[model samples]
Target chain A: MKTETTIQGLTASLASARSSKKMIGFVPTMGNLHEGHLTLVRAAKKICDVVVVSIFVNPIQFGVGEDFDSYPRTLEQDSRLLAEVGCDIIFAPSVEQMYGTQPRLTNISVGQITDDLCGKSRPGHFDGVAVVVTKLFNIVQPDYAFFGQKDYQQLAVIRQLVQDLNIPLEVIGVPIVRAEDGLALSSRNGYLTPEQRAIAPKIYQLLKQAEQQLRQGEMLEQVLANISTELTQAGFVVDYVEARQTNLQPIAQFDQDLVLFVAAKLGSTRLIDNLQINFKT
Target chain B: MKTETTIQGLTASLASARSSKKMIGFVPTMGNLHEGHLTLVRAAKKICDVVVVSIFVNPIQFGVGEDFDSYPRTLEQDSRLLAEVGCDIIFAPSVEQMYGTQPRLTNISVGQITDDLCGKSRPGHFDGVAVVVTKLFNIVQPDYAFFGQKDYQQLAVIRQLVQDLNIPLEVIGVPIVRAEDGLALSSRNGYLTPEQRAIAPKIYQLLKQAEQQLRQGEMLEQVLANISTELTQAGFVVDYVEARQTNLQPIAQFDQDLVLFVAAKLGSTRLIDNLQINFKT
Candidate 1:
C-alpha cells in the first residue's frame, strides 16, 4: 500500500482511481492503530474497490488541557497493521500539510446533540471533528466513509452533518471492537498504567450489568445513580453515567432501543464506553 | 434544458453525465436572473461540458425583517433566459426539499472578515451563504463553481471558504455586469421606482469618480467623505463609502490595487455596488 502525506498526491491518486471506475471507501482515524481501527479498514476492503485510511491526529479536537501534545504518532507502526488489513492507501498529512500556517477561518458546527455528552466536557471538540472530517471527505471524495460506533456521539454528529449538508456519500458506523476483557479499544487506552488498565474493564462490566438491570425493568434513574456510585467507589471519577435514545436524545424512561453511556477518569487518563440495549428483539 | 427540484434526481442526472465524462460547472443564484447572472451562466458555458445553475432564495440568509418573502423568483422567465444562453440544467429545489421540517443542525462560519462590512449590518449572512454554498457544492459535486464579483464581500467569503476547507473544485469569480449607465445589474433593482432607478447609476458613477480621485493622489478619507456627501445629496441613505484591498482587507491609504465599495438605501430599496481599481496594472 502506498502512503501519501500531501493533499495533491492523494487527490492525484484518487483522480486516477475515479477515472478507472473505482469505488473508494475512506476510514478516517487518529492513527495509533489498534484492533478497532483495523476492523474499520477490513470492513472497507470487503466492500470497496479501494480503501483509503487517513491517520490524522487532529489537534483542534483536543481541548486546551486535553491530550493533544501527548497523542501518539505511530504512522510507521500503523502502516504495517493497515497493510495486513488490505488498506489501499494511507493518508498521513502533517499538521502543516492538513492545515496551513494561517488560522483556520472556516468552522463547521452541529447543534443540540453536540451540547451534551463528550461535547459538553470537551468544548468545541465536535466542531473540530466536523471541520476535519469535512476536509477529509472533500479531499478523499469517497463513496462510503467508515466511522467507529465506539465514538457514539461523534458518529451521530457526522450523520447529522452529512444529512444537513446533503453530502453525496454514505456514512457507515462500524460496531465497537473491544478487548477480551470487554474494554473498548482506543488509542488513548495506551496511556493507562498496568494497574489502571486492570481496572478499566470495570467500565464495560458496569455497562453490561446496567443494560441487564434496565432490561429487567429497573428504574432508569436508580440504575444510573447506582452505576455512578459504583464507579466512584471503584476509584474512577465518574464524568457521567446515563441512558439515552440511540440518537443521543435525553430519555426519561426507556421504552425502545437505547444506549447506556459512561465517561470517567481513571488517574490522568479518561476513558469512555457504551452499550446498546435492544429490548424489542 | 432540464430542471431538477430534488437532490436524488439531480444526482442521478449528474451520475449519467459523469459516466459519459462530462465536466460540470455550477452557478448558484437567488433567482430573478439579471444580466449579471446571465454573464455567469455564459461564462460557465464557455469552459464546461454541462452547466447547472441553482436558484435558491435561501431563507436562512435573510434577517428577521429582510426581504426573503419579497425576493423575486422569476424561474419561468429565468429558465427561458438560461435556455437562450445554452444552459444544460436548472436545479431549483424547494425550501422544504433543501431543508426538511427539522432545523438545520449544521452551520459553517467564517471569522474575522465576516465581522465587518455588510456582515456587521446583516448578522449571520455570510454563515448562511457558507452553509448553503457548501450544501450545493456537495450535492452538485461540480468541477467549477461561479460567483459574481458584484457581491464583493460574498465572493471573498466564498473564496476563503473554498481555500480554508480545501473543497475540491475551482471557484471562479465572474466580473460584475453593468448597464449602459454603469449601474451594476441586480435583481433587487426591480424594487426601484423609475425616479429611484434614475438615481441608481449615481452609485457606480461615484465609484468611478472615487477611483479616478484615488488614482490622482486625492486624500483617501476626503475622497470617501465627498462621495458619501454626494450620495446623500442624491437622496440616498449612504450605508458605507470606503476603499479596501482586493482581498477585502481594510486599507487606510490605497497604494496598490483596491476596490471601492458602496451600499445605500433609497425609499426602502437598498442597492450595493463596487469598482475595482487596478493600480499595479
Candidate 2:
C-alpha cells in the first residue's frame, strides 16, 4: 500500500495505474475511520484492481456555525485501518492542497431535491458537498467512485451531479452500514453523548415506523404525519418527515420506488436517515 | 473530412485517429462558419495532426427573451468551409443527443467575474455557457479546447471553470478574428444593419482608448466617464463602461493588470468588447 499527501503525486499514481490497465475504485471520506468506512474499503478491494481511499475533511461543506473546527481527525488510526483492508493508495491532502486559495464564492446546486431534506436544514450543505466532491473527482479521477448509502441524499445529489455535469465515472452506492440495533453509521455519531447515543436508535426506530406504515398500505400523508408525531413524542425535533417518489417528487400517489426521509436535532447536533420504503420484490 | 452527428461516431473516429499517437486540436463553434471561424481552423491545421470543429448553436446559453430562435445557424456552409480549411472531423450533436433525458441540474458556475460585466446584463448567460461548455467537454473530451478572445471574460471564466472542476483538457484562447476595419468577428454581426456595421468599430475604439488612458497613468473613473460620453454621443445606449482588474475585479486604483470592458445596446442587439491593459507594462 502506498500513501501520497500531494495532489500531483496521487494524480500521477492514478494515471499510472490507469495506463497499466488497473481499475480504480475510490471511497472519499473525511478522516476518523470506523467500521462503516472499512466496509467501503473492503468492498472496493473485492471489485477493483486498485482501491484508492481519500481522507480529507472538506471545510467548504460546513456553514458558519457547523462543526468544521471541531470535526475529529484521526489520520494515524485511519491509515492503519486502510492498510488492514488491502487498500492500494491513500490520498490525504491538506487544506492548502485541496484548495489553492479559497474558491471564489461559487456553488453547485441541485434543485428541489437538495432543497427538500438535508438541504433545508443545513442550508448550502449540498452545494458544499458538490464543490468538494468535484474537487475530489478531479484529484482521484476514479473509475468507480463509491459512496455509502448512509448519507442517502448526499448519494442522490452526487448521482445527479455526475449525471448533470456529464462526469465520466460510475457512481456506486453501497448499502447503509448499520449497527446490530439498526442505527445508521456516520462519522458525526461521535458527537453524540452516551445518553444521546441511547436515544439515537429511536430516530431510526421512528423511520422504521414510517417504513412499516408504507408496508401496511398506508397513504404517504398519513405515514409522514405518523412519523412526525412519533419523532416529536420521542423528544427529537423533527425537521421534516417526507415520503417522496424515487426522483424526490412529492408523492401524489405511491410508487414502488418511494423513499421515506427524516432529519432531526438530537441535543445540538443534527442527524438524518432515510429508507426506500416501497421496493418491489 | 468526416461529419459525425452523434458522440459515439465522433469518439470512434477520434479514437482511431489517436491510435497513430497524433495531437488533436479541437475548435468548438456555433456553426455559421465565417472567415473568422475558418481563421481558427487554419490556425488549428497549422499546428495539429487532427483538427476537430464542433458546430452547434447552443440553446441553453441564450436567455428566454434572448435571440435563441433568431440566432443564425449555417450548417451546410459551415461543413464546406471546415472541409476547405483541411479540417479532419466535424462533431455536431442535437440537443437531445448531448443532454440525456434525466438532465442533471447540477451546473458549473465561475464566480464574481460572471457576476459583473456580461453576467449582470444578460441574466444566466454565463451559467448557460458554463453548462454547455461542460457538456461539450464531456462529449468531445478534447485534448485541447479552443475559444476566441473576442469574448474576453468568457476566456477567463473557462480557464477558471476548467481548473476549478479539474476537467482534463487544455483551454486555449485564440486571438480575436478582426474585420478589415478592426470589428471583432462574431455570429451576432448578422444582426447589424449596413449603417450599423459602419460604426461597430466604435466599441473596439473606445476600449482601446481606455487601455491607452490606463497605460498613461489615468484613473479608471475618468476613462469610463469619457467612454460613456463617446458611446452616448454615437447614438448607442451605453450599458456599462467600467475599468476592472484583468480578472474582472473592480479597481480602487489605476494600477495592476487591468481590463477595460464595455457593453452597449446598438438598436435591439447587445454587443460586448474588452481590452487587456497592463498598467505596469
Candidate 3:
C-alpha cells in the first residue's frame, strides 16, 4: 500500500481520487491493530473504490497518566495487516504530521453523552476521541468513514458530531469482531496476563447469557444484575452493564431497540463490549 | 445559477461539479449581498469553474439582541447580483432545512482568539461563527473558501480554525471591499441612518491615517490616540482601534507584521474595518 506522512501529499492523493469520482472509505485508528480493526477495514473495502487506513497515536486524545506514552505502536505489523487486507493507502503519520506547525490547541466537546459509563471512569476521554476523530476526518476527507460498534457510545457521539457540526462524510459502523470464545478483540487485550486472558471471555459469556434471559422476559435490571454477578465471579471489576435505548439513554424497558453495553477490567486492561438486542416484545 | 434549498440537493450538485475536477470557489455569506459580496463573487468567478455562494444568516452566531432579527436579507437582489456575477450555484436553504430534526447541542469553541475585539463585546459570537462556518465548510466541501478581510479578527480566527481542526479546504482571505467614500462596505451599513451612513466613512478614514502614521515610525500609543481622536471628532463612538500581530497578539513594535482593526458606532449602528500594515524598522 502507498503511504503518506504529510497532509499536502494526502490531499493531493485525495484530490486525484476525488477527481475520478472514486468513493474513499477511511478507517482511522491509533495503530495497534487487531481483528476489530481488520473487520472495519474489510467493511470499508467492500464499499469504497479506495480504502485509507490512518495510524496515529494522537497525543491530544490521551489525558495525563493515560496510555499516550504506551498505547502500543506496532505500525510495521499494522501495515502488513492492512496490506494483507487490501488497503490502498496506509496514512501512517507522525505527531508532527497530523498536527502541523503551531497546531493550535483544538478539541471537540461531547456533552452529557460523556458524563457516564466510561466517561465517568475517565474524564476528557470522549473529548479526546472527538478531537482526534475530527482531525482524522479532515485529514482523510473520506466519502464514507468506518468505525466499529465496539465503541458504541463513541459511534453515537460521532453521529451526533456529524449531525451537529455538519461533518460531511457518512460514519459507517461495523459490527464488533470477537474471539471464538466470545472475548471482544482489542489491542489492549494483549496487556492482560495469561490468567486474565483466560477469564476475559467470561464477560461476553455473561452478556450473552443476559441476552438470553431478557429474551425470556427477565427484567432489564435483573439481567444486568446477572451479568454483574458473572463478571464479579470471573474476577473482573465491572464498570457498568446497563441496558440503554439505542441512543445511549438508560431505560427501564428492554424494548426491541435496546443495547446492552458493558465495560469492565480484567487486570490492567479495560475491555468494553456491547450487544444490540432486537427481540420481539 | 442552480438554486438548492435542501442539503441533499446542494450536496448532489456540488458533488457533480467537483467530481469532474471543476475548481469550486465558495463564498459563504449571510445573504443581503452588498458591493463587498459582489467583489468576492467576482474574484471567485475568475478562479473557479463553479462558484457556489451559500446564503445562511446563521442563527447560531447571533447572541440575544445581536441583530439576528434585524439582519438585512434581500434574497431577490442577492440572487440578481449572484446571477450577474456568474455564480454556478446558490444554496439558500431554509432554517429547518439547515437545522435538521433534533439538532444536537454541540458548541465549536473559538478559544483565546475570540476573547478580544468583537468577541469581548459579543460573548459566544465567535463560537457561533465557528459552528456555522464548520457547517458551511462541510456542506460545500469546497476546494477554496473566500472571506472578506473587513472582518479582520474573523479572517484570523477562521485561518486558525482550519489549522487547528485540520479542515481540508484552502481559506482565501480577500482584501476588504469598501465604498467610494472609504467606508468598508457591509450589509449592516444599510442599517445606518442617512446621517450615520454619511459619517460611516470615518472608520476607514481613521485607519488610513493610523496606517500612514505607523509607516512613518510613529509610536503605537500616539497612533492609537490619533485614530481615537479622529474617530471621536467625526461623530462616531470609538470602540477600539489598535495594532496587533496578524495573529491577534498585542504588539509593542510598529515595525512588524501587523493589523489595524477598528470598531466604531455611527449613531446607534456599529461598524468595523481593518487594514494590513507591514512596519519596517
> In terms of lDDT, which candidate is strongest?
1
Q: Report residue A229 deviation for candidate 3 (angstroms).
A: 5.0
Q: In candidate 1, what are the lDDT values of residues A120-166, reduced to their tens digit? A: 89999999999999999989999999999999999999999999998
True contacts kept of each: 0.90, 0.58, 0.53
DockQ-superior candidate, 1 or 2: 1
lDDT of 1 at A226: 89
Every candidate's lDDT = 0.92, 0.81, 0.84
What lDDT tens digits, residue by residue, belong to model 3 across residues A1-281? Answer: 78887877777778778777799999988889998999899999899999999988888666777677889999889999999999989888888877767746555787877778778888888887887788889888888999889989889988889888888789998888999989888888989998999999988888888888888888888889889888988898999888788888767453667888899988767889999888654
Model 3 residue A189 CA deviation in Å: 0.4
Whose TM-score is higher: candidate 2's or candidate 3's?
Answer: 3
DockQ of each: 0.88, 0.57, 0.57
Q: What is the C-alpha lDDT profile of model 1 across B103-161, one tens digit per residue?
A: 78899999988888788889999999998999999989899999999998999999999
User: Which tens-of-lDDT digit does each residue in B51-154 have in candidate 2?
Assistant: 99998878888887888888887888888889988999998888877777865577667778888778888788888788878777776666787888778888
Q: What is the lDDT of residue A24 in candidate 3?
A: 95
Ranking by lDDT: 1, 3, 2
Badly placed stretches (over 4 Å) of model 1 are B252-254
- Going through the candidates in order, what is the number of backbone clashes in each? 0, 0, 0
Q: Model 1 clash pairs?
A: none
Candidate 3's TM-score reads 0.93
lDDT at B3, model 3: 90
